[model samples]
Target chain A: MNLRIIKSGVLDTVQDQGRYGWQHIGINASGAMDRFSAELANALVGNDSAQPVLEMHFPAASLFFEQPSLIAICGANFSAVLNGEPVPCYQPILVNKYSILQFERLNQGARAYLAIEGGMNIGKWLNSYSTHLKAGAGGHAGRPLSTDDEIRLNSSVDWQSYLERNEFRVLPWRASDFWEKEPVDEIYILPGREFSGLTELSQLSLTGKTFTLTPQSDRMGYRLLGDPLEMQNREEMISTAVTFGTIQLLPNGQLTILMADHQTTGGYPRIAHVISAHHSRLAQLSPAEKLRFRITDYSMAEVLYRRQQQHLHQIRYACQLKLEWFIHAGH
Target chain B: MSLTIPYHIFPLGDSAMTVDFGSRISPELNSAVMKLYHELQLTPLPGMVEAVPAYSSLSVHYDLLYCSRHRPAEQTVFEWMGELLDKRLRKLDYEEIIPSREVVVPVCYDISLAPDLEMLARERNLSVEEVIHLHQAAPYRVYLLGFLPGFTYLGETDERIAMPRKMQPSPVVAGSVGIAGRQTGIYSLSSPGGWNIIGRTPLKLFDKDREPLTLLKPGDIIKFVSISKDEFEDH
Candidate 1:
């Protein structure tokens, strides 16, 4: 299957779980900002969890499907439309040859994920299909898709037969369980190594007040505007490795939460880390969104992470079973 | 001589932990970090994915699922990892030899290539020739690779020419050799930088097609060799 980019909206790029095992050498793990949605989209189309999905920002891409293929859309509802008809997210859709899919406007969330059956056949650098924009490597010539760009999909033999047998434009069943409700905007974080470095007043301010995401926010980090969180002492710290959810305090008393495209290492003092379970929800937050932080311990964080992973595993298994049954019934 | 360094392990998040050797930058501390990094790589514990060595610390990232499965049921992932790291720390032989590479970086110090050469020399009350001589005279060590891919942070420059970063960062071309404070490095990728650009190199610090991607790894010894602009262009 082939997809022709009709209108490449702002910051549309192919991303997977992220490039790992390379951070030691200063490589950012550039991946889907909202992993939960990306994985769900892939699962809806019976694709592997690590398969590359189009991570589109608000006012997402418009594409032309060159062949009949099974696809899924998830994450932010960008008012997706197929051939001028509104299409719902969190389910598999069958697009006929020459059908145009377009996203009109953002209904909710900051990003969206679009997945096709058998995944995108894009170039993978450092064992990942993620595009590291700064280095200009990986995923479709290491850059965002532009108008007229053609993205080829890994064609599956069974898909051709399924398309011929099916008359409906979408699967009867939707992966409704995988769809998360609207976010509450409350982010839970665990105290970091330098949590104690913050002044007592600053520590209280972290949880007692609200913070707004500043305009300077990007994939690298979200520079928050709120109370100036001051540290107890003016101490110098050596640069060290930082991860996706690391919250760092700048010298000017500003707080920045490192996101999906965060640098491998940073010198800013790490104040806290947003738990892994809430990462997808955090990714969906846009600039100027009001958010509050809640303190949680390590054990609680681990429990939440494990529970989410278990939920995803169950969802994947169920989706695979459903797809298998559907294919066998068609035969 | 055998040397033993003390270190502390702290949790960065649910999925990562950090082993800090010290707060200050020094050859000994960096070597210690590299040694620990190598040791961990050679005998990786359960769930350990990667170990990132910085100037004086090593950040170890792990897979929580794998760790939970392998760890004792009674202990949490953090507790299990802390204990496992402590055991490894006790067993590590500081006397064990660590491996490193010596790399020669060719630089073109022509006035045209170095946009900030005249300004830097004037600010330091020295001739441009003197500045170039001091930069290439000493062998520098790769403290870390950060800020950008393949951008190696080399340290311990001769204090005579040591200066601060530019008051404001401007657009720097790739392979621009820059110096700020006690460190000098070549920009692997073109981006805005505040460092004083004293020369340029033809070598690509980072290439995706290359085997290792980066030209210099941490702990490698780097020696700058001055070459004429013609030599640089020819290569």
Candidate 2:
């Protein structure tokens, strides 16, 4: 099965979990920025959690289906139209051959995931299909999809049978079911290496004051506008390793949260790292959305992380049972 | 040789740790970094996903789940990392090391790209030619790649070329070469920068088309070669 890109989105690319093991070679782990959504999209379509899926940013992509297949849309609910019909998201849908799927505009949030039953067929480097655009590696020629690009699928199953057997609407699964949502205006953060170096007032302001996301935001980072944070001392710390969710303070006292596709190392004094538990909230935050930081300790972050993992494990078991019953019915 | 190693280990974040070989930049630390880097690559601990070696430290990324599963009796993964670092440095220094490959980068000192070359020369109390000569005189090593993707942070420029960054950063053109403090580098992509602009190269430092796209890597040595505008454009 092949998908022909009629119109490319702002920045759409095929991505899986990510490429690890090669950070020693100076490669950052570039993958789906909101990996949880990517996994859920795959799971909804009876694909493995690790399967590669299309990551679309800001919609506007149009594609033509070459064959009948099972698919699902997860993440930001962009306005998607299938053959001029509005298609529901977060569930499996069966589309016949010659169907045209057009993602017009992003009505909410930034990124959305499109997962086929099996997965996207792409050449792998270092054991992943995720593209590291900076290093020019992985995915389709190691870059974002362009107009007229054709993407092939690995699945050869008879997915058309789903049309007669199951409802086309999404099953009862929402990100909120497995992970809790953060306050609309508050972003949860864990104090980081330079947390103690901030002036007492700056420290207090970090948790109390609200900041608005600037337009200068992308997969690389989120720049914020707010009261400038002051450092206790003016010492310039040596540059070191930086990661996604790392909140770095600039010379002008502005804050920038490094996101997916961020550099592997940085020199700025990091004030905090958004806890993984709240990363989805950060992911869905739109430009100009006001957000406040709430400081949490390490212990709480760890406990929250483990609890989320357990919920994910339970979801996986439930999906396995659903698939087993479907197959046994035909037998 | 007596095997006594002194290093500092610190928290990079909750999930990872960094072992710094020294407090300041020096050749010893660079060697220590490479030595420890190779050793870790040869024998990575359980759950360790990556070991990123920089000018003075190595950052290790590991899977917390696997690390806990294989947790040793003596310490947590963080403590075990510290102990392993000590053992790694205790061995005899791996002398007769692999020589860093030299990459000659062609740069154009033309009027358009180096718009501030005259101003920079006046601040440094030197002629433009002298500035270019000093920049090309020494072979610099790649210290790390950061601040942006494919942006190479190089080490050890001739001290005569040591200068503070531009007080007000001009919009840096892509491929512009500049010096800040004692380090020198070329801008791989156009972004806001304060480095002293001396010249520009035509080579695409961060093109997505090339395999292993970046020409420079840590432990690699580079020398800037002055070229005519035509020569620069041809490459």
Cα error, residue A79 of model 1, in Å, equals 0.7
Interface RMSD, in order shown: 1.0, 2.8
Which regions in candidate 1 have their CA more than 4 angstroms from the true location?
A157-168, A177-183
lDDT of 2 at B201: 88
Ten-residue stretch with the least lDDT total in model 1 chain B: B91-100
lDDT of 1 at A234: 82
Please provide TM-scores, in order, for all candidate models, with all chains considered together: 0.95, 0.87
Point out the worst 10-residue segment of candidate 2 chain A by lDDT.
A171-180
**Model 1, B86-177: lDDT tens per residue?**
89887777776667789999999999999999988998899999999999898998999987888878888989888888878899999999
The deviation in Å at residue A327 for candidate 2 is 4.3
lDDT of 1 by residue, A1-331 (tens): 5899998788899899999878777888889998988998998888889999999987777899888788898888899889888888888888777889999887788888999988877878989999999988998889998999999978574465666654326777676633355455989998988999999999999999999999898888899999899999988776788888999998789899999999888888999999888888789889989999999987788888887778778778888888889878973
The global C-alpha lDDT for each of the candidates, from Candidate 1 onward, is 0.86, 0.76
The numbered model that scores best in lDDT is: 1
